[model samples]
Target: MLSAAATPAQLSAQAASGEAGLERSERAAEEQQADNIIVTGRAQKLYRVETTASTKLPTEPLLSSQNVSVITSELIQDQGARDAQDIYRNISGVSFFSYAGVTARGFRQEEIFFDGLRGDPYAGFSVPQLFNLDRVEFLKGPSGMLYGPGAPGGLFNYVTKKPQDKPFSADVRGIVGNADRIGGSAEVNSSLGGGFAARGGLFYEDRGLFRFNAASRTLIADGGVSWSPGPVTVILQATRYDQELDASRLRGVPTDDDGNFLADRRWNHNEPGDFLNLRSDVLQARIEAEPLPGLTLDATMRYNDATEVQNYHEPRGLFDSDGDGIRDATIREFRDQRRDEESWSFGGNAVYAFDLGGDVGNRVLAGFDHFNGEEIFAGRSLRGRNRVVAGLPSPLSLLDPVYGQSDPATYNQGPFSIFNTDSRRTGFYLLNELTVGPVIITGGIRQDNFHDDSDGIVFEDEATTYRGGIVYRVTDEISLFGHYATSFEPQDPSVQNPLAGGPFAPTAGDIFEGGIKTALMGGRIQSSLSAYQIRRRNILQVDPRGDVGNDGVDDFVAFGEVTSKGIEFDLAADITPDWVLTVAYAHNDTKITGDNGGGGILNRVGDRFANAPKHQLGIWTRYQIPDIGIAAAFGGDYVSEQVSLSGQPVRPFMIFDTSLIYEVGPIRAMLRVDNLFDKTYAVSGFIDRTGHFPGEPRSIFLEVGYAF
Candidate 1:
């Protein structure tokens, strides 16, 4: 831990995390239970957290220069959040872009972190499971200095549940809803004595969507064991996750120019046979030792294997063969994709805390990480990552859709390349934090070396990023911080067209940010006010040259620059010990500022990023009356209008949700209702050329659980 003055964030979480917090939590079950619906106190912090998931020096969040937003396990349970999308409303400046994809800080983000690992175990389109996880942390801005190549908009880091060295504790839950929702889960954690502990969980759910012919089923099995002896600790864990999206890739309903659905709200073009599936297995091991009084060493390793399969329909467009102004028919293409991916990652870091003299201290961290990954992808159609083989397209009526008109067996499956590619990276990083009196200064640097091979075509590259920041303790209740950071990302080797600046420079981004954190109302309310400007260079866009093949789709190029500037405010408070509230607001403006060559008004200067709203707000509040074992939670999310890639308008929308809870002894129950007004809205505007993704109209789910 770095030597620094105490801040409000630290004061709020000093009693809620790690080993020391565990001991404090056991005695404050009734107090923390105000946020934890399970009643039994979970060691991990619920509403407030003190530190980030750092392998280096640990510092309080408010004092840290980076901007990070967290979603604790307690928040997930209180909202009855079923998946990743459900919790997006709790964070500011986050909106849906596509399947398992989000627009964060005006950039479409896809990559994520599992624990301290940089790679995602699940496939791109696969939705992540939340049951086996402890919390989600969003780190904003360029992180290349710490994690490796990625988008500048930032990434999500998920912390998994670990074995707790305490008395035996178990929880079981069952859920039911109106829309074919039936789910259950069981979890157990216990101390095996002799410095040994174990934890395990099983979760299964089968749920239907608001749209017709769309549904999902998921199963997850996870377990872990840890042994702590003297000054050393070792942990081993394994997880298996399986999910099936039936009648999958339900992009959206066919809509007219005015955003009115030409078909029913629940319309779906896919047949019952179409599906998207994913299966992943992962193993992880770690060891930590404190051999000296002020020195710590940690090492971790992970092995992951995952397979994803997709069989879905892609809507070509609605057309009137007769050239009539009114279109009634649509063209559909069948797509088949299968991929198997594997990766191995190893990392080690050491931190040493020493004092320059009295009242002054410094902590230095040095680490190295290596990753090796391989992928095998196969597709039946040339459109989806295939070296050869072309598929056929079928037609359907927009007014009266017919199913089972297309078959994958008819497509030519010959001469397809399944040996996709192999990639590797190695990173060496260092960080230093120096504390002098009331001021702290920090700096970090990382050098990443990348090697990739696609079908024997090999490419090697390297990038070095840097970060510097300062935090000044003005008073015990307020702190001011500022930072400047730079990030880098490697481009896809396949997009090497000369017209679009093929073999172009890799993407680079930078940010200048400042913030003030304050503790008000006698340290009960904590708030942060911040502003930042982020710029992305070497962004991929449409090529100025017309489509040589006249495929009606413009080609892609890499010669664009974008800038996003935003102001955000967040507040979390414990109002009177029985009530808690969190509020978030953001205003972001993203524009295409530079373009070398552009045509047809696409990817041109001044164009806004698609599906990114300029304004967003979220509020959540929970209150409990301890005397009666009853509590209530109410929350809502608001997002402004946005422009789609096709130059269509995505209207603004607001949704409100509420939950009613009843707890007595070890039994707990909750009734959650989402979209209370059944408003008609779109989750994504013009997500594709011919449709807009419809939002869930209304939903109600009931949960019952027992814990001891």
Candidate 2:
């Protein structure tokens, strides 16, 4: 939560103290170049202005009264981030909860944006490469004002690296690592014919896990062109990604009740038959014009299409206990699912700066914006394989007959039962900012209209969101700020179709937040603290007694409330002339403020939310030596224990990472190590289950590149 300071004057004094220490550290780092400089291929700085969350006024996007984190291209390269998931790991207050491609923040969803365009984290479609990215910005808090409909946790904006004014530039890089993993990227940026510029890039990577024959491959392509004439500029871009996985199964080890089990060695029981495939395409167009002095207008249009397919199988005999001390039962089950989706969004915004008459002070930034988007998702699953047959009984009763295969026809596990679902939304917003002397105040409002149509089923609704904030410059290096904002999202429908029997409905939320930010040491150091409380309504859950194979009961439909109260702290500083450090912390209490479980186990656990970690901490530090052209970085993240559906606490785990880089003229070489300590832990998985799968183990990589 945001801490209360003594006074504005006192805050400034504290900032000064912090700044002095940082400058000294930098100087010391420069002197100890040999020890400080480790070549790591990560970005060191970022563009702070354009990456914020405010969509109404471009002027206030930099200081939008919301917590913002910027990850520059320099940091991406330095950290050797491979895909979108890697970026999420580097950022604080974010965590991937399950292999379902879902990320969580204070037990809520995490929103995603690409080049300021909407993207879905739950689609489970694509993992974009960082090769063509310029930087990534994390906007903390509900963003219903800027986005049509969104989550209350926060949003991530991935800014693409556009073509520069330079005539021509090209780069080719490659990385070689364990598990026969070799990958490379090619990027080119150039000035085309008269009044035009273009950029294009391609990337391909493959890697393996410690598990037998488990490997994955990813391919990405992105290209863009811009045409400029007079005060107008038009740009068009396209991006495509395809990721393929051979096979991966949930990890498990031998255990004897009481949760005691073995280590890295897997029990020779479960079958190795699971795989996933994903493909996505994105196309966008942008137009910008300087219609008048101190004013600029921008309009953007984008289209996205994605497809995902997965074949999941869990051996029914995974719990085998043979009289000969061997895994005998060979039962098998598989689920195949496919989802195709298409969506497009169009939006425009205008930024105007004006001055009030006389000594009343000058007011800058009057703006308005509008956006609309639509998406469709459809999928199905098949279950029921192993038949129960009475047999001998041991400490663990053995009655069910288990085999390696099941009848696909009997289980209804053939092609699929098609059920199309769609979510569409539109929004209009207006904002104004007034700056007088050392104080700046901003106010804005957004009207949102959302419609969901699933298989011709329609649900329409609308809401108006509002926000207001003020910032007082206590000193040149410190600022005091507070903000209040409201946001919402259309809840997922749970009512199954009368004929098809699939779920449909909408859930919404209300969020309130306040925070403070400070910049010191000639803008080399930045820090912020924020506190927030989010309340949600109409939370959806599955019925305990309802037919798992059919939608029969209405117990799945219920009304409930969840509240997430949390404090976040972030800091970035140039500790020494050659050293930089970034740190972040989050403490959250997310729970069901009002209970209505609809007969689910969740309600029996005192209304506690699942998969919500109470505490998270992270630190990253890098040292660069211009004299010797070397850089190095080290960091790790820690998450507190989380509770399961049975009210059992899952053990916590920590992951550490480090990298080094060396630069000689235009040529650079780097090495990186993830999970350096070979810490056995579970990054993400299901709850209420004992044997949590082990995450990626110690991995090493080497890379070489040249730039023009």
* Model 2 residue 362 lDDT score: 34
Tens-place lDDT digits, model 1, residues 310-399: 888777777773467777666676777788999998988898999999779999989988999898998765222211123554566667
Runs off by more than 4 Å, candidate 1: 1-45, 54-56, 321-324, 382-393, 406-419, 497-502, 521-523, 540-559, 599-606, 686-690
- For residue 209, give model 1's deviation from the true position in Å: 1.7
Candidate 2 wrongly placed segments (more than 4 Å)? 1-56, 59-62, 100-104, 119-122, 248-274, 314-320, 323-331, 357-412, 496-506, 540-552, 555-558, 597-607, 645-648, 688-693
Model 1 residue pairs with clashes: none
RMSD list, candidates in order:
5.4, 6.7
Residues 286-337 of candidate 2: C-alpha lDDT, one tens digit per residue: 8989978877888888787777776654444333455576443434445566
Best by TM-score: 1
TM-score of each: 0.90, 0.82
